[model samples]
Target: MEKLFELSHQNPALFVDILESIKDAIFISDHEGTTLWLNSASEAMCGVPKNKITGRNVRDLEKEGLFKPSVLRMALEEGKNVSTVQTVGEGRKYIATGHLVKNKEGKVIAAVAHLRDITDAVKNTSKLQEIEELLEKYSAQIRKLTSTKTNINGVENVKLGGKSNSRILAKKIIEKIAAVDTTALIVGETGTGKSLAAEKIHLLSKRRNGPFVQINCASLPESLLESELFGYEKGSFTGATSKGKTGLIKAAEAGTLFLDEIGEVPLHLQTKILHFLQSKTYMPIGAREPRNADVRIIAATNRDLEQMVEEGTFRSDLFYRLNILTVKIPSLRESRDDIEDLATYFLNMFNEKYNKNKRFSNEVLKKLIQYSWPGNIRELENLIERLVILSEDEFIEEKDLPQKMVEQHMSSNSPYISDRGTMTEILEEMEKKMIIDALEKENSTRKAAKFLGVSQSLLMRRIKKYNIQLVVEESKTFVK
Candidate 1:
């Protein structure tokens, strides 16, 4: 109240000391946007010394990456108060407010920008968003569980809980195909959960309340399969029951009939299966009339029916009919991110079954992930059950692993588990190492591509992406 402007002009050091004592950062700039002066708080917030920024223009400082978007410049250009959130260096955030200083004629001469650190607020906001997202995901899952039509249980839920993009896409595909009542084909490697997929589809479909009858075509002889699938009339053939038998198709009336290993069905029986798919009718042996059944068909196969069709084995027509709504489950090796989750699920399951408290050592689990699961999920499940039953120690260790896995671990150069960085980063490192090994052994890009089972263009792109340095000698490439 003692005329602050006159006091500042009389003793500038007093004003400077007063501004320096303030907690918030204060930056002063002339109307032309050149840095005039700033307090110690501004120097600390900007992570730069006062001398480095004192005489520089705001535009030059912005170009030098001091702080994004000069707030003083904003106040000078807009001729009004301005506020903005700005980022400095790597992770700090600040809320900047700019105000203009005017002369007696109301002409702007200087601009003062105040900055308040809001890095904590921004981090808390990001954390809150993540929590909300997690809540929403759980809410969606709860909704699916409460709805009977969409209720997926047992191994179905476990299979769908994969963190990989492929598994997430398969879950979406299952949900979509379940809504529509139609024939669905499940295709995957022998142990990749094709049967679980089919069962999940049946439970999620409109036929949840009805019986789900399953038959493995590969397990039955042609003569027996034909009789068991279509049923037999009374006194139909030798050894036939006096009373007619109900076939799987008829037993699953108003429900779903899961044909496991449909690709193994005989060519003669393929036509009959195609007929059932087309007309929803089949004839019982020794019956004069065709029997009608209200049942949905869900077929699964590890065999490539299309290739079989080309070889004159599986019927093309039947393959076409079942291929309309297909669900392809990725093998455990192809979806490595899901391996840990699946292994843990199987461990818990076998533990519960055997009434034992057992867990895998960290190294053992890493070896499981590193091993190429040719038998897919089935092999992993069996291995867990075996360990749960046979292992003398409570914790399954690396020594307890199979010989092949231990050999592979010894021969492999890549890390089985990530000590730091994300899964993606760990995978990239593995890929880089493999590429380098291939280049060293093959000594040529084309040969290396063949060894890696990838196209030359793809290998080149990956090499470029990883920034791998290669030394070429007489058309041979070497990783430097």
Candidate 2:
């Protein structure tokens, strides 16, 4: 013990000098966020000697213009570590990260903070991001040109709506997962363009040159569907072809096989699909051995598979297998911001197809926006085609629109959405209320996360951000 004490005395600057020599600013504050100690670097960065700032409240430093808002004060208020950006002397940007200093008894005693100068790094990052954004835009244009030049069906028209957040999210999800060979399940209401999305994915994938095989499970009965998928040997069934035929799985070798209306697949076939997904092998009828194929599965369904699983109609294992890389597309009614753009696009497309020139009047376009499109994009496309063919006048007037559309347009104005500046403020207040309500209903962060479809850590961040009051202590136990 005496030898260790001598060594520590010989190298006391190892601790103090190192903290003083580091570039980042460092400081410590008490439970009340009163500055207790400030290292030499922090003192230099703030341009105030430690003797002047120590023993003073951190919030007071903000008032004195030593720095911007105090991250240490925020950490103390939130009872957790906090990070924020601050502008210091000479308009330089610094990133401050606050840590919650806990005692041996597991109670927070003080907060420590480290501030890093990031102005130059931030500028470089911004420039790099701008370059990347330009590259992404041109790459998309190139892909679109190729699709058009090659006359790719279904993919040429498949686009994420510009104005709808839901559609934007779906497009991002698709783009992110397309790089990997993961089984994808697309869920949406009928006519919501699930098949179009599948075609676009295949076109955008690494296997774009390979064939895209498609089939609708709902159009075939169990026996026929099975035989069609796993093509049989000659005389395997009553109407079998004289020569042995290849299955869709085999036909889509080294490509993508789209199974539309996947929910309609029978339970007996579900087992076969699961086996193939697990091992990429399927047995044909009247065949002694199984066949292996290299096909990527992209399944789409308009039904609730979870409900079907609970009712024992769908196998839980198959549901889990298909549920990877899920994407839920919004219905047309939920995408009001996209109505005008879609209507114009469809008008131009059908005009070219039918060799007619027809335009919608402003009033008719307004009516179209207000109408609740229960039949979704398919219905909209069909209606556009009909309007192009049936309307004798060059411009389709409001009177020509369906009667239901006019009635709905007159009553669709929402009362709560005026004054753009106030919208975010109102939404923030509502978000706070919702978090409190969800926490009350569930009494646990795990349930709250599930209810909100967000990570528990994010929920905790929001809780601290809002300083939400609670009736009971937050259930500290987390599920994952």
Candidate 3:
């Protein structure tokens, strides 16, 4: 038994070193289901250093919540190779293949497995739905293992507003995924709550107790952003302070670091960020040694990174790294059903904030739903805040809305055909009403048809279709 398990390290074929050099995680366990070895890649992807669990039993690792439905255990039980997609390392997706290792006498001596991290590969939007379903299914096992956060009705501190299907669906997805440490890429138009979504994911995570550091890539020049994200050493530059500064990555240790406007990041910095994503290690500027930070990354971008990659503006590698889990927050116009709910929520929020008792009039609510919010949620919230502060009356009425918004509402929801009917029926109804009104004025068919700009015969046909009487008793409809 000792001789069979010794080949990995004592055979001198350098199999252990070979596995360590490969990027995919590799694990080996003896026939008794005891862990024999785990390579460096396995240690990193599994989020457990080799020193912590070397020579430990596989059951202990499972009990410690290292990974779920162990492929190695399954392989040992079935006495054959097993393949599966498992959730590991705080909810990361991996493609795992476990094989039964045999001795020279054809006896099963150990179990070996290779795990490829597929967190980012499966995140392409075209494959996103299928991947999400897969993650959700496997994540159930993981959730049982790491149910550390206080959950409310199977959700966490996700505060996404609005009751539209799109909004609600988006919030539900975010809550389900918030417990994991996977990198999330939020794609939406500017001011569409991309940052808010990122924050919610962090707040709902196990790292909620840690800081939520955010840095906008577009807000600073390339030179300054590098220092801000990766930190700089003392005397690294002319204006360097006596005390060295910590990077956002370092500052957000064991927490969440949100990179907002990630599409605006320069090419060189993208490479560094990609390196950090891969290894969780970074070298500060002018530093002699690299340091590792245990931080979860959530990046938001409005630009089309794939298009930019085609145009050679954004690096493809970095784009993939950031898009491990993509959440596309829809524009406000796309989620019309949520308008009223969002409006009411904001109304109550602003009322409490400004110590006001203002309310939104029925007309105001109608107008709000009608207007197309090109600027998304941010624009809506800003307008509500302004209305609450500026309105003299207790209610924000139609007049309180901006001119453009009011005109848009009027244009969209005009009173034409307010009742339901086919196009031809509506035209006939209008024709009948016009003919009746004109006839009451002139009391003659020729003058009525003339005022209607139609032949008398056509007006007569429409009148028959609408069943409107020609009586002039009170200038109103009296069917005959």
The sequence of per-residue lDDT tens digits that candidate 2 reaches over residues 196-263 is 77877887788677777778887667876776678777645333323555677887788788888899
Task: List residue ranges in candidate 3 displaced over 4 A.
Answer: 1-158, 239-242, 410-480
Q: How many residue pairs collide in each prediction? A: 0, 0, 0
Question: What lDDT score is found at residue 426 in candidate 3?
Answer: 59
Where does model 2 exceed 4 Å of error? 1-162, 238-242, 409-480
TM-score of each: 0.53, 0.53, 0.53
Q: Considering lDDT, which of the candidate structures 1 and 3 is the better prediction for this target?
A: 1
lDDT tens digits, residue span 222-292, model 3: 86677677877875653332345667788788888888889889899899999999999999988889999
The models' CA-based lDDT, in order, is 0.81, 0.77, 0.77
Query: Candidate order by lDDT, highest to lowest?
Result: 1, 2, 3
User: RMSD of candidate 3 to the true fold?
Assistant: 27.5
Question: Candidate 2 at 153: error in angstroms?
Answer: 4.8
Candidate 1 lDDT (Cα, 0 to 1)? 0.81
Residue-level lDDT for 370 in candidate 2 = 77
